[model samples]
Target: MLKPVELDLSELGELAQVIPGPEPKLELSLSPIPQFGAERPRIIPVCEPSLTGNELKYVTDCIESNWISSAGHYIQAFERAFAAACQVRYGISCCSGTIALHLALAVLGLQPGDEVIIPTFTMIATAYAVTYTGARPVLVDSERETWNMDLDQVEARITPRTRAIIPVHTYGHPVDMDRLNALAERHGLWVIEDAAEAHGALYKGRPTGSLGDAAAFSFYANKIITTGEGGMLVTDNEELARLAWTLRDHAFSSERHFWHKFIGYSYRMTNLQAAVGLAQVEQMANFVAARRANAAYYTELLKDIPGLVTPPQAEWATSVYWMYGILVQDEFGLTRDELRRRLAQRGIETRTFFIPMHLQPIYYEMFKGERYPVAEDFCRRGLYLPSASSLTRQEIERVVDTLRDVRR
Candidate 1:
């Protein structure tokens, strides 16, 4: 039973104005892609990249300059820009968010049998990254308030082997970083932010990436700021950044071209991707603003709906609302899946929340009989609405209207 946070009506009204023109129709003809014929029903996507920026021009430059591989100027430019946005000094660009997490942990020197604490409610990438370093990911249930790792339970799981704690800002809501940092410091543990979905989020006015020892961000097609398929590790630690940059490109020793000092990876982001990333970075502020505005309006419209729990933004956190999620309570008369199916029938796309790590088939046997009540509860009830930054007010209204119609 998570209590909803109070929505700031004044702020909501102010931000809602940022949304551009009228609401878009729920339908989108699928004629553009040759795969889907024009007959395909127009569906409002759950998430989509807004590429109205200089993505094309930057990409064309990369191609013309013959620097489209991983070694172009755009890569460094994108990295620096994104790092600055996080208020950090360094950014190590990588091929994907999971790789960024792995690189961060690797630089921290995680060893086999070491344990890293993480929320069971997060995407599997967090756990997988820890596993990549041969370190075990110790699971913690989520707190109801922020739907983030329960800091209260974290201490109980810390043991001699616990070396780090990866705090995931669930659904773009910043976790209580100060509290988590204090707890980690007391235990002599490193704090790594799993900020893959929380671009531009703030915790007590500080950017999320700068709050931890190191943070990972995803630039996937559906993320707040996309590079099509890329990620970055932002940090203030020079040594960590240096090591990650080296390791991401096969750890080729600088002393000699062919010599290798450490086992490394081919986790490099191409300049082509960085081109798009820089374009996206240039528009990150607007993207974040749009997401916050959309979340505010969605909350306002959905607040009156029975059994629907809109996402929460803690007083100290300014959530980017990466995906505008809602929890379906038992009183809703319809199960979460039922609501999703009905939404789909109306040509609206939706996505279910992440299933906890303990419930994942790959990790099931390892965590057999382990019950993280809060994470499991979220999995059963949570679903995201259309949450793209490109969403117009009319589009949001339509989505809300569909929810109301289905509930009836």
Candidate 2:
């Protein structure tokens, strides 16, 4: 069993007095040995892609073929491969994850006044996508255990205006898909999963994208796998895929040029991006494995710390651990902000978790007086550790050591 160590914040404050404040660091460093070279400050980003030789080769092939625009063989190849990976019938590539969500809403024919249930603890894009479709986003609190949408609260929030539910797999942890899907089925509501943060995540032996009617993914620079900037929508419905494709590319009819069938925005993915995506997709399994390994290492290092709670994996959910998180307990004697500041002074980069969207200014204006106490409290205390894939074992050790020192 792990023994918890109580943190002494009073000691930390006194130590901070002696600790030197932030200073401007040199941009580069030089060494006398020419061949040995010099070292630069390594930036441990939150997430990074692990590229393979095939990625470069595919880009070279795209250059050689001159299929560098939005339409190319690489696009179709990536879509097919990604769809296969997700165990879905079809996949449509788009310009961004947000655009993919927008496409999902549009393809589903969501209209003004329709209500979409979203988690308050997710990236703003989830709710923004619903708003883009001229629908209202009814935000729900997260489950304390998994940090995903609270299923009971979601069920309670459903109304006559509710048209869909977008359960975000936050930080690559799969939500309670079985329960969410069951709720959707019972209510006859559309299930469009906002899986932007969970590419290879699984629930009950099935991939996240395959668990819903439709799902969206992101390939932004910081994601586990990146295509520079791209996204994808996966679905088993052929007609929905066709609609998404048309809507992605200006809603043009395939039969004729410039034949506008419906009003749509140009959210197409370039062949170059798709080429990069195909390369990244080929390496996703390894990337996910590495991330999981890193999370395990973190858990082993910090599980004994008192006043700190590491992310918990659900019984039926297998998380990719895109970002390792730690919740500072009230008894810790240190606020999340204070911990973040102290870590920064030690040359470690850390970030707080998402601020619940329900408390945002825009949402406040819309809802006027609504409040989610649990979501609000979690946001005030949760902090994300440095879990970047580029982070080396030594760096992780340094972070853990610093954390241990602070607690002591």
lDDT string, candidate 1, 253-290, tens digits: 99989799899999999999999999999999999999
lDDT of 2 by residue, 1-408 (tens): 966543332433332222222322311122112322354335444455666638889988999999999878999999999999999989999988998899999998899989999998888899889999999999888888999989999989999999999999989899988888999999999999998988899998899899999999988988887888899999999999999999888888888989998888899898989898998888888888878888899989887777888887999989988889888887777777777666665556676787667555456457545666666666777778887666677767767876776555
Per-model TM-score on C-alpha atoms: 0.90, 0.89
**Cα deviation in Å at residue 162, candidate 2?**
0.8
Q: How close is candidate 1 to the true structure, as a TM-score?
A: 0.90
Clashing pairs in 1: 23-394, 23-395, 28-42
What RMSD, rounded to one decimal, does every model reach? Answer: 10.1, 8.4
Model 2 residue runs over 4 Å out of place are: 1-41
Best by TM-score: 1
Global local distance difference test of model 1:
0.88
C-alpha lDDT of candidate 2 relative to the true structure: 0.82
